[model samples]
Target: MTFRPLLALLMALSVTVTASAQSAADLGASKPRKESTLPLLPTASEADAALISAHLLTRFHYDAQPLDDAMSQKIYTLYFKLLDGEKVFFTQQDMAKFAQDKDKFGNAIWNKDLSAPFDVFNQYVLRAIDRMNYARGLLKQGFDFNTNDTYNVDRKNADWPKDQAELNDLWRKRTMNDWLRLKLAGKSDDEIRKTLDKRYAGYIDRVKQLDSEDAFQTFMTAYANSTDPHTDYLGPREAENFDIQMKLSLEGIGAVLQARDDYTQIRELVPAGPASKSGKVHVGDLVLGVGQGATGPIVDVVGWRLDDVVNLIRGKKDTTVRLEIVPADQGQDGKHEMISLVRQKVAIEEQAAKKKVIEVTDGGVTRKIGVIELPMFYSDFGARSEGDKNFKSATRDVAKLLGELKAEGVQGVVMDLRNNGGGSLYEANELTGLFIDQGPVVQVRDARGQVQVQGDDDPGMAWSGPLAVLVNRGTASASEIFSAAIQDYSRGLVIGTPTFGKGTVQTLIDLDRFASDPTTKPNYGALKMTVQEFFRINGGSTQLRGVTPDISYPNNGDEKDFGESTYDNALPWTQIAPADYKPVADMKAYLTQLDQLHDARGAKSPAWQLMLDELAQYKKLSDRTTISLNFAQRETERKQLDALQADFRARHKAIDGADSAQADADAQLDDGLNPSERSLKTELKEQADAKKAPDPQLQETAHILFDAVGLINANPKLAAEVLPYGGKQGNSASMAAVAGATPLPTQNSAGQSGGASRAPAAASSSGH
Candidate 1:
């Protein structure tokens, strides 16, 4: 089945308003005239839209349940989390007052009564303004960094303060932490004071700028997200942005951005976009400032709205946008780097699947292995609909690359899907077809309990020689589908971490279609809701559990911080009757031996050892929830981290230098090429140089595949048992027996009998 273009769901809901005649006493405020800002009130159109949205969510959503007291509590809790996730603004007393109508949120949405949510949001505005003012006041007094104290970095589960005094204490430490970060970054006391004064004032200004639309959107989104994290309500402006993104019309740095606390964080880089090609920014990096052109003044965006930050970053094609970002690996250490990228439309050619060959030497034998790196499952649906057979697609590009690799005489191929967040459900099926002759690839079950099996009807195999599919936590949806299919069919060994467990499907529904009044037709925005769930051909749903690899590798990222499993209300893993399909080959019996060979190599390889050590250091940093307030201790920690990063860079440089020398030697053999061919080779070399150092994971995978090929060639019966198209029996002098090679102790790098355990690092969200 064809799928619609996937849009990153934006939850840009906040509280704001204009002044009304209602007195502070009438509105249940403790006092009045603290600020000249007015309160926001819901409009009639918003109320009507909310009621209609509630009906659609309750009636049509996959796994929809009654919007009763239980759902109301979920909405209530989520709403507060949305408003004050750090638990700094709202006090215990405020929560107590809000709890009285906590169970009434569901009924309020159903009956078009927005007063309860509106009143709660208005109260939040007052509390937030008070805190900002308090923060500004503390900057004047300065901080004593010598104090032996600690500040909790993550307060998502922290309790609300009891009263104003308790809130003030929290803000005191918060302000001190802020000041300490700036000081450590080499800013003078005067600069710190000035910067903070502007930041806090900016926060208050942004809060005051929220209108009724913002409040309603937040409330409605809270209700939608209570059912599932993927279900979201987009306001009119957000809906328009989504359309622009889908059409690939927005000219910008091509980074998906989101608001985290007071900072705008990079969620994902659009594949082949300016940011992705720049090789500087990364997911989870926080944007601290933005500038225009090559020499524009940097504008501090610490407390700016996400939309405002996005606007500042976007520019005409060929123009440059500069970003000041704190790297994700560095946490909040206050050190940031500047990156400048030329805004450009995403190039489809850059995103197409690419092929390269690597040589693996094992047990005195050398073998050629081909690697196909697919960034995403893209297909030009518009072109295809217009009967353009030459339209680019993941499957078509991969098919051509496979033919080229076969011509290059590679013995095995690794389908690298790491960091591929999935697109084009149709491409996923067709891509799977390129592996096996023809069979069912995936199963989909709608909300009505009807299952439809999607498969390859074409009877042809592309390159069926020894195969391996590489994946990681960033692999989701269609990527998961393709990986799971290969594993289920016993066609290849899946290596790397577990796939991102995003098995559900969402479709955008324009709320304007449900409008009874013509005047409000297109003003209601849209709702992206979960309409179906994906199931594997083996009867298991790739929901919370995802797809476990045949041979697991070490992953530094924390699973809890990313993937569909991170959503508290995510759909449960389930099973259905297995689809009718035949297995091509079984690799289960060979996994133990492969794992042993991999572990032996990993223990001896310096690159592999360095990677493990780096992961350990990163995990240690990521696991910390609190940071030292003592200036001396913090400085020491920062110095140690800097040293570690320097060591890693130096080691990588050494390795790259060796690789570059070999690459240069290979380039010397291209003298006989035509002018166009030479130019293409030069272009490819430049692209390769722009990428980060060679991936240790890809090299290790090639080693494993080489071992498998040797084993198949040495043991004639093994090929018939594990090879789909019988055995290609005939061993050359180079194809030696892998079993004859002495095996090292089976202990893995982490000293476990199995593979390495998943480590803690930044998690990549789906479709970002």
Candidate 2:
């Protein structure tokens, strides 16, 4: 399939490269390090090859090109960036040696040779070992907190050190800064030294653990990213993790785990899961140690492999596991707590759509707004393929929720798509069908310039009342498509900041499934390649420019650091001819008044003000790349940050009640678990009817919807202002005239590359 070519729409996102084609010179260049005399790492074999990437990209990539020197340049730069992101390990001399073979990467990869990249990586490992040893040695020398020095935490744009002396100097300040940070955290000299020693040792061990598969995956990622940021390859172990995530079910604590610096952090709490229900463990909590059951010595999980930590946390249902957690976002001090939890199956129902009705009063009239939180655009593809009519899906659940809302006499409905990183593409179409009559929802264009319009065929409308879609930076891919379609059709008002602009679709192909050698084990892993680009019915691609809410709120994510625009290789945004359809109404006509009402209401909300203040402080810290190493200076800064945090928490407490009850309950639950079957009842009863924190964003959106209802009720014609082609052609008496932006590119949508053509999925097809 092909796609239309228009001017670049979005800013670049990011890239990476790979290694082989061994030489005597390369073998001789390998240097042993004193940090750790690890066993010789295994090398890649043909059976675990990456020939699939070259073959698939040339055959199916949206912008397929020959493996040539031009592409190799990108791979070269990307590989180095991946290996030494902070430019702390490799020196200028090291970079010069790698630069010589920059353009040869493509030819080597295409010919199944990887010696060059591997040799480069070997050098990197030695350099890293040397640096890590240097940092570790610093822990023995007591640091003087009175020294006035600063460490640049972000060195992506910094120059590579010229020699060992220059690199050593950089490491000195970095070590000092680390020492100062720990000191300010109230760590004693002995404790500080031990923690730093362990951290550096962990780094060395992690490097020693690297094998050929790990190296290949990293290089392959760089190679794939040379084309697009989304295209990627997952090794055998990574592939297993991916599958578990897609299924939204795992035999673990049900906490989203992420590697943050040197610690494994709980990124989020999955509702109904052991963690969330425990109410003891919250997001931003870091796992420092893990223990089996409620007894025995706890093993330090800090600096441990993410998968290993996950394994430690997982067990059979009713089994007990203990976690030593350090509360994050509280203070930098090394305070910690121990919590015990009984493991259970993390089922999909825990993440299903949930509904709550909130009453909002506007002009003395109370309006009940039904809110549905959609965590993901999930679907039971396995069940659906088996022809199960009762299969679970986001669309089906939401449709049922809409019906119930109607029964409850809700004046409006708010679909909360916050932090929802989209899933099923088919669900986006089906969900849009619930709000509007049959019409085109999204458009898809392939590499061959063929455009395919994906529309809703279902005529049944679940709810035709006032509606709003709430989104944030985390809402992406399928979520973007659904929201864009709703906006194009003018069926609902979108509220919140711009979303994550991910307009491309990916197709995962299991290379093992199609291997020619029957004797080969089915473990070649998988390749997720970008196959198509999606467009809204109004002819705009949500590539780099995400869906803009009709009424926006105070943004917590800065455009410079977050969203598609932050990526250096993200697909550009463009436009095509608007899809042939008529909008249900001109929702844009009420945007001005809605904005006014939103501002007026927000001015009176202490919660909104507190959120803004916190956001501002977050941005300030995020923008700083350098940190002072002086103990006094660092302590003052920490104090200021603590003040901001304390004030914010205080304001939150005043509005949302103290967390004393929740804390007490958490302590009770942690101590109550019996590590056996009898522990289940206590665990289950603790959070059976727990009340969730009120959502300020949803409440704000409800008020905005109330304003929308008030305007529409005052002038009913405004609700029937049929604007054709998303208000591009002309405006009606009820609609205002606004100049249209660039139209989406019109081209044939077919996946054609290397003189090959292939059928493409529907435009709204999701690559989840």
Candidate 3:
């Protein structure tokens, strides 16, 4: 129901290797003394919004100068596209008013005066609401369900006249779907109409529940964003609530709340926390009834907004917020599981570094390999800077884990960086240092074109066993930087599909910090500015092109599903002059062989075929997003896709030996199948698992290392043939450092390079 495990779509943040940093100090700091980038808070400030916003514009700097007219207009379009709502969404009247009073907005947006920020923010919120209403209408009419990232293709219709046919038709269908849902749920047409009172009466009931407090609360975010991506404004109650949320300790069932249609949905339930511990309050479970204590009757709150529900749930320590939970899987008939729980703070520990040892026995030689998972590199600056010490960073924990693994005689290390969306830049630099001795790691060029190279300060390789880095479309930002460097330096094998193409950097500045803090409830906003681009040491930009085709391996990632290119306004990829570095053997010729081997295995594997089939089905459904209209048609299409997915999942489960005989018998009876099925049947796979000998990607990396070992063994002969001018100078200096930096000969418990772990479950659960 919820996926905090690895949300690649979480707000953007910078990775390591950029010179244009948020702090005044140089960008090369391995372990920063303080997190100077985020806006300092008097209280605990390492919250979601700050992290989310800072994640995006973390490396960029903000300038006071106004944007170019062209840029402003483009941003304007984007702003509307992203902000417009689908129910009670923005309407035609909203755009006309804005156009008529452009001067009013212009002054509010750009006036140098201090009052301008708050005034502009107020106006922005008002305008946003109007647009939001229209957007909601579009959603109700069955238009593309868009969010901040996935803006509807048809939303840019404000410039032209939009009638009810073109404008609200989509929203009407969505409303009809809701209407259908009510009808299916056993609500008679007469009963629903009588209960609703008017066509938009259902909307009105939700509107009153929305209220000024909630709307203003959202407005404050827009106001806070005007300054930078870190500083934020919170009303008296919200500030306290936010503080509780960040500490991972929360009262009232420890659930993240949000408005979903007419109900307040539980977004995230802290695993092992109060709600999760109870096991009664599952994610997506709705809290429609809250009682004071054990005996209080549960109140009907189906139509209540989020804040009201939260208020009802709030209580003193040990006091119960008797929650009437509607189990996620059930619709209106969802079981009411009353959970009586004490209000207590729950600490969030999910982000802590995790370590696992994979066993590989190769050629009868057994070796244990270590794998470490780090979700984010976070630092509590205020706590550490005050000399409290013991500040947490991914590098320190990983280094410690490496030492522990080395002590256990682990041979190779695979840095499982897939879905590592990135965090503290300081961790990226320090983490890079763990792998290699002091050398240039990455270069950063700012908007002004000032370039700076961030290098590794340490001079010793940390467990340099056969290193392999696992990455995919979700491995982004700092994760990308570290992986690219490892690949560039020939320090490790780059496995998995192409990474998330996010190479830009942003910086957050607190509007409140830049202005006077009003004694009478000061409001704060943050501005996230994209200022610089991160680059590889060899001058390759890790932007849209992202980390390039490294040892080709197959993954479930479809080329067009999701990536950097998914967005319309993403920056393009380009290259600069290559850095002065030793040349590594080209893997192109070997990659071809590896690709063929992988294709052979995947083609025959039913598990892989099922996944490929699912993709085909989703693609077909997505394609239907265009030209597909009407509530009935859309519902039918959705039901078909969902059914196909369910069938595919059942097929996959059957392959896993669940009702195996029955499933297999069913499959054998069917002869006319798609090309994908035929392909699977044709290629007999000896390698459904990576442990099989035919796995070429592993062979290539191993062969590269093996060849280097052979070179080291025949050093004298190599020097004689490859370099005639040798001995004390020239060619002696030309000798490659292969002997010094080869990855450790690690083995899994199975003891083979091929036996190294494949992150199938991790990849599947994390999607890409």
Candidate 4:
């Protein structure tokens, strides 16, 4: 049951990551062969699933096995489609070879050993190629169907795909109609080839015309991404260039490209990536053409698939490769617009993190709030603790950031975790420790329900002050861990809609590790199995339900659309006994009032109003089955929406003259009154005023912490020896926030750390 180190699985099946040696025979036909000559391959249905499962684990970095062939089939087919066909590229000859082979390789490959012929391995190899080719072609010719590239990652770290019908069509029609168009255009085969060449020049500026590339990549990305959230299969050299692998040490235009529908489109333009350095390319640019050297006619590659297109763009570093692009959001009728860009080596420094400071007027005082965006929770797991390593750990960096923010006299801090696609688990635990005093932040229960509690090693909190943690739906896995802990401990006010659940843990299990003999399949693909589930200390599982709303915000993610919580047969929500513990403070009595206040202001606030309208629209389009088939009506609806948005944006932008009303508020301030603040000028003023209450969300959190502190103060005996200063924390029962006045981390002027505290505060639970 135990697969040694899953590290190989982690590094296995990486895109553009070529295997040691894959001979033509290895990638060739899979026909009947004598099984007794070597090791026996799994032939039984059950055995097939196990073998396939093993392969999946090896590739996807999963730690579990499939129960049957059906399960393996579902996973394999789904993954194949997700991968935008498959990784191995083959030509028509390859397909024909497999088709003609009949059954020469081995019985295991065939579904029917006793009947005609069914070598799935060989058949799929060819089919996968066709699929990839088709996917590529579709990207070139713009898609004609409505496609949705959606994934669901819930709190438990599980993911599933949505919009299957359109997705399937996107895959199927990717290659068809191309040669037919050339034939119908009455162009000779040679003539068509020549046209293809001249059209290549048209791509220099249109390289950003990534319409096709984006679709295919998005379509297939779910395959690789669906795996352990890592271990992608890079189809061509273009994929490798975009991977940003420092270890490989290749240099080229710093642009990431993917096959969306037909063309190779840019996924992101690294800030200093050669493409960006040229000042000609931008993220979301669609590449329609390319030019190899200095200056010439741009290649007009309007309908080429990604592989062929990428092959044309590939070149050495410092070589001036011209690119063509249609900037994002600039297409009208999807016309072939063009702009040119040069290629250059992408600098690594540009990919590093950046920080910003925002000031929000609270309680009539302008306080600086620091914002740090983490793209990935990356940390060099290989060279840590045991080696002399200068590793980049999100936790360590964040701890340092807290110090800097505190020194800047920032009263409240907001940890922006939006779009943080997750990284190391150790880093997640360590990051949570920076805010919490440190304990078992999360529990990892394996497939058999064996739980391993992950705790913090650090005793010092980087910052303990009024804090706000911001999240959107994209926050997942390890991300969910930190957020879940904060909520369970009532550490911070959870804002935004529900997060991407994705709480399930996956471990890559390589079959090569279990092979009794090495002669069989030396190295098979990996499997990304769901091996463990994460649970919060409060007993609530951060599984399919994900993190619930504390203070909801209008965000770009569809709350009900994406995230693991929306998947079928996902793990259910459950909880274990609450671990014996205490938090910084409680805000029960405060939450009620705060919620009421938020409800009131939220109704009046334009932001919330707009969000409500958006949510209503979302409700209407909750399911495609429910949508009208009337195309005319849909167009009319689109027009109406465009007009509505235009008006809102216009009015909001012109709020200047419309809001000479601010003059009234300024006049009130001149009369010894402040009107710009969301709440009262002071505690005294708040107590006196019947109106102008603080936001319910903020008030609720503050009041909870305030009351929790008071409760502890009133029952000083409860904190007696542990009140002001406590000894080292022992078990869960005695666990409390690190005690001391290292500036009670607070998100408010009153110094209430969002989730961490100077001392363990009283605990209060409320329902409703």
Best by TM-score: 2
TM-score to native of every candidate shown: 0.73, 0.75, 0.60, 0.55
Instruction: For candidate 3, write residues 29-52 as lDDT tens digits.
Output: 122111122111222122222332
Write the residue-wise lDDT of candidate 1 on 493-596 in tens digits. Answer: 99999988888777667888888866644478888777788789999988888889988888786775778877788888899999999888779657888999
Tens-place lDDT per residue, model 4, 28-50, is 22121111121112333323323
**Residue range 43-121, candidate 2, lDDT tens digits:** 4443235666778887889878667898889888888877777788888987887889999888777777787777776
**Which parts of model 3 are misplaced by more than 4 Å?**
1-72, 85-97, 102-104, 111-161, 165-168, 177-347, 356-371, 403-411, 517-521, 552-596, 626-647, 659-768
Give the per-residue Cα lDDT of candidate 1 at 762: 13
The TM-score of candidate 4 is 0.55
TM-score of 1: 0.73
Q: Between 3 and 4, whose TM-score is larger?
A: 3
Q: Which pairs clash (backbone N, Cα, C closer than 3 Å) in model 1?
A: 16-210, 17-39, 17-40, 18-38, 18-39, 19-38
Global lDDT scores for all candidate models: 0.71, 0.67, 0.47, 0.44
lDDT of 1 at 682: 58
**lDDT at position 504, candidate 4:** 67
